[model samples]
Target: MRHGKQTPEPHEHGGDEGGVLVRGARRYEWSAAVGMLGRRRQVYDGLVALSGVRPGDRVLDIGCGTGYLTRRVARAVGPGGTVVGIDPSPSVIGYAATRAPANCTFQVAGAQALPHADAAFDAVVSSLAIHHLPADDRVTALREMRRVLRPGGRLLVADFSARPRHLRLVNLFGGMTRHARQHHPMADLADLVGRAGFAPTGSGDRWPSLHYVQARRPLEDVSAGAEASRP
Candidate 1:
């Protein structure tokens, strides 16, 4: 439905305001050089199946590197619905823009400070982006995702497994773990989402490394003990 204007370059979000491990533009360039090895399709199917994305749902994809998953989401949501992908890199958005269908748009934005208003989306999905953020930023980003969801909306995050033993050999190499140093273990990620006000639903790994977790905002405001106090 609504499309954001195309940006040629990523707007500077400033230096390591909480130690952002990966800068957007740099990451985009690197990804372009290396190429995505089925990551987009793999994560798209996993996230879609896990989130139960349906027709007419307004979805948001955070860190949508090149709109691969965003395009998939748009297809799932159909013409009646809309999908928006946000990434820190304008170059990534530019690539995404060319391939994006009419129902989807790509914007340059960070997870910690989403550009949308509260309760703007029906479902929020993030893949392989949280670990790139600093310890505190991860929590803040999660909270921001929750804030932008309507009541009972779901959030799904897929990323590398934090458990050292579970990682693939490539992930264990030098400096590969730099951004991932602060990656939350499955349990920790669940707890962090719970603390951010979502009710953790489930978590699991996709074989060797990638881990996915799902959580949902409560339909009723339970933070004030109102729901718990109810008989």
Candidate 2:
């Protein structure tokens, strides 16, 4: 298996041998302060290639720890567009809340049960996350992402591949102490996206610790009523 020169930091729920999660989320400050310089470039390159977020577009950034990417998305979408960054961790959200640009906003929310309406966003993006939740939740969250997107909206997810057979196992072993769960291998990610009513945009680079899936919700039959409401 290929390994990165840079090891992922611990997730908040430290320790292994419990729930399926993998490594804990790194300290929010570390990611916000310096991680953005590199991750932001990757995100910008991917979103621009896949979603084509124009000025005035409404965007949602899930798992937006530190809101760094949210800030970048906000800048990309410009004054006309709006970007909302969401994370379940209050600490991460707190950091992001204070520093986000005027056009950006933040909320405390989980991926599976996003507190948004059908077709609420023009584009949705996530990075370095998604594997922390269970396989079922991953699918559920993807469906939620599709539900909130405008007809013809875009969904861009940048994460480590659950792909290659051995990588996931390694993550589980390495992250046990770090509190991370390993879910669907990379091969299954496409199927999950398809099951969620998304058509593949197919621009993924499975190298240098980055894996991504970009999908589009066709405008032809996007039904606002088809969205499932959460309790």
Candidate 3:
């Protein structure tokens, strides 16, 4: 059920380091795992709302495993808009591509080095994926996200933020939940987003185990605007 070429070249930025990639049959397991959380549709729909994405906005989804959230964003954007999803795993990318809506597309790339032009998207979002990134790479990935967004674009990042005791019990069984157990504190994520040059807007927790931070790229880049105007 794969689509397009088996291996499409990734973005020119090229680094594929940081974060774990889900591959093979394991990629198919996410749907069930997510269902265990209950209210799956509502949780993800809430993320779409938190993202502030509107119809006709060009959106990007980083670490878009299985395209679950990407598909939802596509619905929000409508046919006038387009959604591009990137993940480091070719397997999941292929899986996602098969089910992608006409206005959506999938690519193989990592969060730290997104394969898109600067100021290309109207909004950027990630769900339950930031925790999969290595600590050092998280900021770098956020910077990349900021770079891809147009001035005034919205940014939303959600990840597991369950208390340690709760995570410990979940991690005992291993698998994907292991990453959740080791996720960074949501405060750290807020700080990182700020450090990446986004203006903090809001943050909160979703039922089950997701924490989200919302921010906006400053409405203007004075230095960049000055440089452009000079020419």
TM-score winner: 3
Ranking by TM-score: 3, 1, 2
Candidate 3 lDDT, 1-231, residue by residue in tens: 544544432311112654453334232345335433556678889999999999999999987877878999999999999999998877677777988999999998988777787889999999877767777777778888888889889999987676534545656566645334444455577888887778989999876667899999898753322222221
Q: Which parts of model 3 have CA positions greater than 4 angstroms off?
A: 1-15, 25-35, 163-187, 222-231
Q: Rate the local accuracy (lDDT) of all candidates.
A: 0.68, 0.65, 0.74
Candidate 2: tens digits of C-alpha lDDT, residues 14-104: 1122223323234344332232334546655555556577799999988776676788788788998999988776555655677888999
- Checking candidate 1 for backbone clashes, the offending pairs are none
lDDT of 1 by residue, 1-231 (tens): 223453244322211245343434344434423233436466567678888689999999987767777888898889998999997766667667888899999988877778887778899988766665666666777777887888888888877665545333334543433333444454466666776778888988874366788988788843422222223
Total clashing pairs for each candidate: 0, 16, 0
Off by over 4 Å in 1: 1-40, 162-187, 222-231
**Candidate closer to the true structure by lDDT (higher is better), 1 or 3:** 3
Deviation from truth (RMSD, Å), model 1 = 6.6
What's the true lDDT of residue 88 in model 3? 80
Tell me model 1's lDDT, rounded to 2 decimals. 0.68
Q: Worst ten-residue run, lDDT, model 3?
A: 222-231
